[model samples]
Target: MSTHPHAPQSHVHDTLVVGGGPGGLTAAIYLRRFTRDVALVDKGNSRLRLIPVSHNYPGFPEGVPGTTLLGNLTAQLERYGGTVTHGEILGLRIEDGVFVADCLPEGAPDDARREIRAHTVLLATGVADAGLPIEMWREAIAFGSVRLCPVCDGFDVMDKHIAVATSEVNPVGHALFMRTFSAEVTLFERMSPTALTDDDRRRLAAAGVRLVDSPLLSVTLDASMKPVLHTEDGQEHGADVFYPMLGENARSGLAAKLGAETAQCEEIVVDVHGATSVPGLYAIGDVTVGLNQIAVATGQAARAATHIHNRLPPALRTASTRPPSPGTTM
Candidate 1:
């Protein structure tokens, strides 16, 4: 973790990026390359930190751990004079033509608050998924006994027994979606009141997806280290991978606070350039609507940074190497 305390003054930045995950780090690199003064504030709870391995990302045939990938991105950004500061952004507001945010520094004194002012702000705050119901959840994921994000790891579970569990009111759609990847798919509708609607039953029958009305009891590794799901009815279902269909909670509170439009899922609505309804306020990565993946985040970051760079006036076009000193307001 990193910390920076403000000396009772506002620090002006060309762009202030929130969330130090893939999107924010990539945006920092791009902005620094464009000679813009950019700062990334991260609370260090990135979903990427939980990934044991990613098999779909390009340039890594052998697969790469999430932490490793994040480190690589951080190094790349630092090489270009961009760095991530660990802080929790407590408030965000726009005044004049600049965005101002208040932050609490990590590992610093309780009274050491920091204020950041920027011409532009990018919210790359990612989302979090409800993990599987297992005591050794992290170990299970590391051993491929549990998995999430069918879009990212569906290939690994193809043609294998897949168990999906979700807490959504309507878990049928997620169950049906997983059927495309494997025929041996079982959906555990544990939290749904009306677990299956007429349409849901019809679709599940058509897709050959087995429906388990019983709630999950426990999950543990079997002899071969495979995930074994035990149900309330004392029935045990063994699978190659136990996938949780639990929906993700997007970290879009700041965006909503700024009156930005968001989808029902709380994902920020953004244009192709990652600009939200508010000018100079942008969003990217899992925080925005689209495929929630690292590659997608980096692309959105690139586009947003470029758009911000091009939108600046000639006088402010040059990259800002130094941040505003204490007491300096934008």
Candidate 2:
């Protein structure tokens, strides 16, 4: 809904936002409210769209569907005359003190690419979860049988039978976290059990988390629409909800290409204002090393937009506007 399919290719914007997730859209809104020329480009793969419903996000007593929330934000941006360009940015570089983004617009040919230029750039590209090997896993997610974030939806599964599946060498952490929400928690190690240390076993046991070391062969839904796990050892385990703790892949390649600092997990490192190591470039949301929540993303967007506005040259005004002294308010 935020997309402008026929956006001009040559106009340079004040700030170009990459990603159409909550953070990117929020930033575009703020920049537009500040009267700055802003352009947003989205590849249409935001993880927020995968959320069935969110109860943790404030102001939604009855909860809101993910798609509905995204649509609301897009609509808000449009009210401010801000539009998003549907495209996949293939490359980014600095040319004459401006950032240039080479993008493949949606439905364009492989050889066809467009260049978008901006004085500053913000990357709100979110992460992709390492999904389960089950067919129709997304359908299970929509049915509330498979969840992604424990911090976000653990309360919804309180006192319910929950299964945490992971291929990590040590899988006790998430299992223990799940124990706080439910009495019956199972940790399914989808890899060799020998990788787990004795400390991991003791911790899991102390937390009363059942450790099932058998490799996960497949996952299916029972007649009750609950997730039933099939182990390689010819065993079946049923649970009210399934959580894949396999981890995630951050979409920070664009920032990395500009020599931005990143963590071992490839999450972009940013300052308090969301500015990356590369000057005039910023990152927010799950792509940055921080809490992956909608509230956090919007807050980061606000801070980044304010900082960017202050950094850019001020527009013409009749009266001289200057920053107030420290400990003083204008």
Candidate 3:
């Protein structure tokens, strides 16, 4: 929330991190600690902000709210003299061996655009879930009735009646995965049964997951604030928790515009160090092809920051921290 002014046009940072999520903030911290000039731009739409509470992230035994975690990361970055500009990057391109980002400041006039220059750019823009059919989906998530990642919150819904609803014809994987946490698990297909082969049906039956061919008409909260699914056949089913397995859309447009290779799903393709196919460009977190978890994103940020630091020229050192010559006395 630090309202620092944006860097002047002539000020080209050593690295420019796009997005203000955990991954981007962590990288800014690392790069600043290395004494490298860093700039970060965020549109303020990270998916982490929607998570009510996370029990999977390590070191927090009591669990932490997503907003609290994000706030802490932002504070830590500011403490290290790093600032995040509130803007949407309209386009990214390389010019004269440097990255130029065309950005639209948040709430600015449509024609008022500015360009940010940097030697290297890190795209930490995360993905967005398709979400549920409920109008108050975010409120449902806060109420712990509508879950997103089963891998992240499955333990919390243990022994509860779980419902997995997907538009895909065969979404047995998520239903089966939820079955591991609860004995009463059901899979509701929102599409007409066409691609659901007999083998798929057999697997669900073997796993004790009830398969519902009727599409979910709507989902409403019951008296207890639990999700109650109304199917096409006028049958209503209530569950302790509901998961919409529609899919996710990765925010890799900026990287794609820079000629960076991306997966079929539009996730940025990255190397072991999180470097993209384009030189001086890198991507990490849900934007990249990997597990979309906060822990994984933070770890990827560390790798990319270290690699960028080593690849760039050594930062200027002050006399106090300068190394002594072999024959020189301290």
Q: After superposition, how far is residue 105 of candidate 3 from its true place, in Å?
A: 1.7
lDDT by residue for model 1 over 1-330, one digit each (tens)?
A: 111224234556778899999989998888888877777899998888888889998999999999999999999988887778898888899887778898888997768777888888999999876545685788878878787788898887778888888556556776677787888988876753645678887888989999888888678888788988888889988888888765787899998999999995799999999999988899999988888888999889999989998887543444656799999987
Tens-place lDDT per residue, model 3, 218-301, is 899987889889898999988899998758879999888778899856889999999999999999999999888999999999
- Residue runs of model 1 more than 4 Å from their true location after superposition: 1-10, 166-170, 315-330
Question: Whole-model Cα lDDT per candidate?
Answer: 0.83, 0.87, 0.87
RMSD of each: 6.4, 5.2, 3.8
Q: After superposing candidate 2, which stretches have Cα over 4 Å from the reference?
A: 1-10, 167-170, 317-330
lDDT score for residue 27 of model 1: 88
**What C-alpha lDDT, on a 0 to 100 scale, does residue 175 get in candidate 3?**
90
lDDT of 3: 0.87
Q: Could you tell me the lDDT of residue 142 within candidate 2? A: 92
Among these predictions, the greatest TM-score belongs to 3
On TM-score, the stronger of 2 and 3 is 3
Where is the poorest 10-residue window by lDDT in model 1?
1-10
Candidate 2, position 98, lDDT: 86
| Clashing residue pairs found in predicted model 2 | none
lDDT of 2 by residue, 134-190 (tens): 757889889999888899999999999999986453367778888889999998888
Ranking by TM-score: 3, 2, 1
State TM-scores per candidate.
0.88, 0.92, 0.93
